[model samples]
Target chain A: MIQVKNVTKKYGNFKAVDDISFEVKDGEVVGFLGPNGAGKSTTMNMITGYIDPTQGQIIVNGVDVGKRPRKAKKQIGYMPESVPLYEELTVKEFVRYMAELKLVKHKDLKEETNKLIEEVGLKEVENKLIRNLSRGYKQRVSLAGALIGNPDVIILDEPTVGLDPKQITEIRDLIKKLGKNHTVILSSHILSEVSQICEKVVIINKGKIVAIDTPSNLEEKTKSKNTILVTVEDPNNKMESIKDKLKEADEIKLVKDNKDGTKQYAIVSDTNVDLRKKLFDILPKEQIIIFELKKDESTLEDAFISLIDDSKETLKDNSQTTVEEQEEKNLEKNNKTKESKNKQKEKNKKGSKKEDKK
Target chain B: MWAVLKKELKSYFLSPIGYICIGIFLLIFSIFFYLTAIQSASIDLGNLYYNTAMYGLMLIIPILTMRLFAEERKNGTEQLLLTSPRSVTGIVLGKFFAATTVVLITLIISLMYFAILMYFGTPNLVPTLIMMFGFLLLSMAAISIGMFASSITENQIVAAVITAAVLILPWFLPNINESLAALDLMNYYSKFPAGLLSATEVVGLVSFAVMFILFTVIVLKRRKAVK
Candidate 1:
């Protein structure tokens, strides 16, 4: 379990991770979903105690990471991004060393190291120098390093970034296996991977958390309408009149015209309403041929993009309002200054006229 | 800490750096052996060790210590090391002793030169050993400085350059002031060459090693906050 409270990391004036707080429950597979430079790696680094947070407290397994890094770090198994490894070491040696560093008892160190090597599927290449292994194997070696002590929490930063498709699936399965026991927190820009592998998704953008929920919940929350795309052959040109029969449908518009004399129309309705059955029955009675009718489903990818875009739009609106407010103040100040200058000019004219009369 | 020590020692032999450091140290020692010991026709191994410690260590220690931390930082393996539960002092000492072990191996091999001296004529074993002990102490002090230099940079070349400068610049200190000669690492070897184990020399060399080892640990610990 990990609790990050008001954690912020700043480099000079740039806040890499800005006042972000999140928690990973025991045995929860949490996905840190973000675009590039979204502070995912920085957050992971802070959680693992690899880098100190500029301001915050990260508690791991009830121990504050800053105050007792050694005890807190003992609970975390971190595989950093890019699969950093000791190229000079064999896979077995690396894991053994990691086991020892984690303060594993000398008695169990050997058995644990070999078990981890087998778990990560590096048994065949266990004796190969890490430098000679493939990228995917190197990643496994790094994973074995993290899994050496069988820590309660596993933190992986973009674990499947550069792997082949086959390797990606293998690694994802390995992570899912890891999640059954350890609290797994992995960051990735790949939406499908997160959706398939993680139970809870935390979307971060621009050093801020945009949304956090179950993947399906996020998809459902971002679904604004139930859209049904119906392709039909309306020889009688009755498609336009079909709207009159369906009262629940909010809007219907011709989407595409097929050269084969079939037209595709999109019907939109309120969320949670299904218009497919009505359209299926009504079109036949109206002498229209229904070729295709299916509802367009929203996925986690759409949810992710929409959430990130919405946050960015809101940020733009906030800055625009501040600029407009500042402009309004400046205009008011200019008007007051102009009015005072006019009064002073009038006073000077009145003095000149009085002097002329004298 | 033993984990890191074992890996560091293993890596030394696994890579060419270990062989290169030992090869160059022995090469320099052999050259000095012929020039100072055989040419001077003297059985005293003191001058031979003094010259080797002065010149040979400047080359070998940088090669031995430059990659200790610099390579890890560059390859991003420092993330693995720093995130581990091991203390910074432990990692520093692990690397320090590992590099020292390599120097110890080369020094042990240099005993063959002393063996050769015995075949030709009688050599004073006690003074020669005191010189070797002084040589080991001086090398430890220099290696610690090199290790500190490596921790401050990711570039191994820059680390080596900084380490070499640290070792070489002290030799020039006496040119600036007479009192500064006490700070020269080579000055600590003077008592050993005369067959004496002066407390001042031993304590000075040890404290110097301890000071830099402590500095290396501090640099690594501070980097976690700033990195």
Candidate 2:
């Protein structure tokens, strides 16, 4: 349960997070998706009360982070972007200290510390100092620190960065498990990770929120046309002419040519139109062998890129479409024409004076 | 506050800084022990603690306090500490007491000199204890200054230098202006060596320590905004 209302963070004249507002329901796993330096970490820090927001308010479980930071912070377990940890401390000692900082009861501290150490799979290395641990283990230690007191909300900034694939999967699985009971907010540039693990995705770009939706909804919203990829062996070179038979197909473009003489074509149609049946009936009659046919389903990666690009386009358009900007362009053009005309008149007058002197 | 205090205390011993501070204090105190008490054949332990607090603390205080906040900020561990539910006052006080405890441990070991003095000659126990208490206060005041220096910067070297400058400069202030002698911590220790429990010196040293401790806390609290 988190509510960020019109929160903005400004550094000098630059706004790191610009009027961005989003909420996470209880027990929801929300993914903060953005490119590097897209204000994701800044937003996470504001939510955790690690840094004060330049403007607006962040409420954690009904407590304002700015007003009652301690009470609000008590409900949050934050693993910062850098995975800040006490390198000199042993794994168990670090977890125990975190438990104590979270004010865990002395009676339950040891048991809770051990449970978290095992949960993050650092039991064998529990006694080992954190400085000697590998990066993955260090990350797990940081996570254990966050999870020490079993806080209701867990905020991890780029949880799986720099980890190997296996370690990434392990961490992702751990986060997914965390999502079952706790409200989790994780920021990452990896779209597939967000799509696979998060229930809702908030895409931010250039200090602004581009879009916020479920993973599937974002993917589906970005797909404007139904696109199908068809690979076929066209002995008679009838692939281009097949578009005549499938009238529902809006455009047929060659995508690639295979070494086996089969050509791949992408057939795009208007929404609610199915070109597969018509192509299936027409291709064989036209002396083309159908090899592969499947719809081109867009992934969250495509959705993210399109959303970011669309926001960039809108920003550009906003600057270009203003009436004052149009008027300024017209004035510039008029000034250039007037300057040329004056130059021509001056040249004519100089020529006439030379003629008169001769 | 207790949680932060315990962890900070544990961290002091876990790192080499704790052992190094203690070892260096003892080494200097022993050297002073010989020169001040043993060689002079005097039972006054005041000069022993006096020299230790003067020369030994110049090095020990920086070593103990330079890493208090500088190392945490440098290593990014400040994020973990600041994000927790603990207040800046609690964190600063926890570290303050931890460094003070290390000096306390060294002071306890320095009592062996008092034991030896008791064996060979009669030493005034009241004056010795009074000086030791005054020495603790002086060290606490110096530690608070060092901790304040550490909180303002992320560079340990810079923090150490600032702390050393803060402690070393006040000694030279009285040389420049006789009236500025009150600013000197050693100036406040004048009466304690003679077993006179002057309330002015006690309150003065404590208030000085409190002033710097509060400064450190304010520095940390304000960092939350700019950081």
Candidate 3:
């Protein structure tokens, strides 16, 4: 189990992570989702004890990280943003070295290292030097390094970033298998991947966490309007009048024209209404043959973007109000400077145009 | 600490650096042995060790120590070392002793020179042992400074250059000022050539090695937070 409480990382005046807190229970697979520069990596770094948080505490299995780093760090297996490996060492040698560094018992070191090599599917290349391996193989070598000590908490930062589709699936399956016995925390900007592999998702934006819930719940919460796409053979041009006849339909907009003498329209209604069924029943009564009807399901991608954009707007508003009250004069001066620069560029373009005309 | 020491020492042999350092030291030792003892027609092996320590050590020390921390940091493998369960002191001491062991291996091979001297004439065994001890102490001090230089930078060339400068500068310092002779490592090593184990020189060399080792540990520990 890991508990991160009110952790914040400050780089001078810039805050990389702002007072974020979360908990990962043992045997849980949690995905950290955010856009780039959203503090997912920073939060993971603090949890893994890679860097000290400017404020707050991280406790791993009841041990405070700041008070007893060695003990706390012993429970974490971190694969950093870029998989860093010792290129000089062969695959087998590197894994054994990592086991030794993690203080595995001398008696079990060989057995444990070989087991990790087999587990990560690197047994074939175990004797090869890491510098001679491909990128995917290098990533697996790093994963093998992380898994050698069998630490309870395994933290991976953007683990599948540069992998191909097949390799991504392989690594995802590996993480899922590891999740059976280990508490796993992975961060990525790929929304669909998170929704597929993670049991819970933590959404962050602009150094602050905006939401934390299951992927389905987040997708459900942000879906305020019900939308359905319907394709119909409206030979009598009765599609425009369907909204007026069906009181449940709020609005209907033409989406596309099909080549088979049919038109597709997107119908919007209240969240509680099932417009698909209503459209199927009423459109047939009007002698309109329905070709297709389906409800639009909001994906995790929409939830992520909406949440991040909402938080960014709120931050911009807050900063704007503060600037108006405290630094109006300086703000005005900066705006004037920008305007003059734009005017100078405009004058240069006009001069060039006049020279061409002459 | 044992884990890191084992791997670092293995790496020395796996790469050409280890063989190069040992081979160079042996070559210098053999040349000095002939000039100082065989040509001089003396039974003294201590003078051979003293000249080898003065000339050959400066080059060998940098080669052994240049990549200790500098290469690790450059390749981002320091993250693995720092994040591990091992303490900073263990890691520092591991690399320190590993570099020292390279010099130890060269010293053992220099024994063949001693065997040759014994074949020609009776040599004082105690003084030869004392010279080996003093040589090890001097090498330790130089290796520690070189390792400390490696920890402060990521560029191996810069680390090697800084280490060479540190080892060579104190030799010339005594030439500029008479009082600066106290800073000279060779000055501390002077009595060992005469077969006298000076207590002050032994203490000075050991303390110097320990001070730099501690500095390296502190720099690595502090980098965890700053990095």
Candidate 4:
């Protein structure tokens, strides 16, 4: 288990990571998701004992990383961002050196080096110097070094950033294989990769965490029920004024114009309104034929973007907060009361369904 | 510590820097041997070690130590060494000993000059051995300073320049003040070439080496916090 408590890394006056706290349970695969310069690498470095946090305590496994760095570091295998390795050493020699650095027993050193080489599929280049290896091979050599002692936690920073699609798949598969046995924390700007591999994702923006939950749950959070996308073929272009007939619909946006005389528009309405049925009833009478229509389903990518934009909006609000702290508090209170009233209405709807069943 | 030492030595030989340092030392040693022995009609090999330690070290020690830490920093391999489950002292000492091994090899190889001197008159064996031992101590002390120079910068050329300036500055300092002669590494070496192994010189050289090694370790440890 890894617990980061109130961690804040300040560089001069800039706070690179601000009071961000999260936990990775034993054997869990967690991802640090953020845009560029989002402090993901900084957090990984702190966990590996490579750098000290300005203020905070990190407990890795059971040892405090700040107090007992070596003890905590021994349990972690860190493949750093740059894939640093001795260019002069052969793959086997490098892995053996890493094993020795990890204080692997003399009896098992030789066997362990060979095992990691074959494990990462570096057996072909075992005798080749790291200088002569390709990027993919070098990445595998770094992974081999990190896996030598079978550390309990393996932290990889941007493992697949500069790889081809084929190499990306290979390395991702390797990480997945390691995830079954080791607690893995990987940071990537690629959203689909995290959604595919990580059990829990910590989305970060501007040094602050925006959300921490399962990827599917984040996708669900951004899924809007009131938005429906429709592909329509309108001869008289009456789709523009269709909102006048459907009073419940709030806005109709022309999303795209197909080259084949069909156009796609998104219909927006209240959260509780089913806008698709109303659009179906009103479009034909207005001389518009609906070709295709479906509800909008946000993927993990949308959730990541929306969450990031949400944080950006809140930061803009925070600038005026110093002058009107009380006004903002009251506004937030009013919003919370409105949210509670909506929740009460939802509960009443569920109760009415139960009565119908009775 | 053993792993780092072995890897450093392996890296040194795998690159040309180790051979280059030894080659430069041997070249300087041979030139001095000709000047102090053959041309002067003398068999005193002690003077050759002294001359080589004085002139050849400024060239050789910087080459050996310039890339010790600087290249690692530039290439990002310092991250590997710093994050390893080892003490900062151990890594510094590992690199220190590795560079010292190259110097030791050059000293051992210089016995060829002694063999040639044996064909002439018998060089006094006690003074010659003491000079060789003193030369090793002086080189170790200089190596620590050179290593410290390497740790302070990431550019290898800058490290080499700083190391050369540090070593060459002390030679000319005594012109300003007589007490400044103490800063000259060779001032403590005035006795070793004479046939006596002075206790003060031995302590001076070892203490200098220990202090600089500690400085290198401290600089590396402090970088983790401030980096």
Query: Highest DockQ among the candidates is held by which one?
Result: 1
Top-down lDDT ranking: 1, 2, 4, 3
Return the clash pairs for model 2, or none: none
lDDT of 2 by residue, A227-289 (tens): 999999988887877777888888999999999899999999986887888888888888889
- The alpha-carbon root-mean-square deviation between model 1 and the true structure, to one decimal in Å, is 8.7
Error of 4 at B17 (Å): 0.6
A181: Cα error in model 4, Å:
1.8
Regions of candidate 3 where Cα sits further than 4 Å from its true position = A233-241, A246-251, A258-263, A285-287, A318-358
Residue range B74-117, candidate 2, lDDT tens digits: 99899888889988899899889988888888888888999998
Interface RMSD of 3: 1.3
Worst 10 residues of 1 chain A by lDDT: A110-119
Ranking by DockQ: 1, 2, 4, 3
RMSD of each: 8.7, 9.4, 9.0, 16.2
Q: How large is the interface RMSD of each prediction? A: 0.8, 1.0, 1.3, 0.9
Off by over 4 Å in 1: A235-241, A253-263, A317-358
What DockQ class does candidate 2 belong to? medium
Candidate 1: deviation at residue A27, Å? 0.8
lDDT of 3 by residue, A167-238 (tens): 999999999999999999999989999999899999988889999999999999999889998889999999
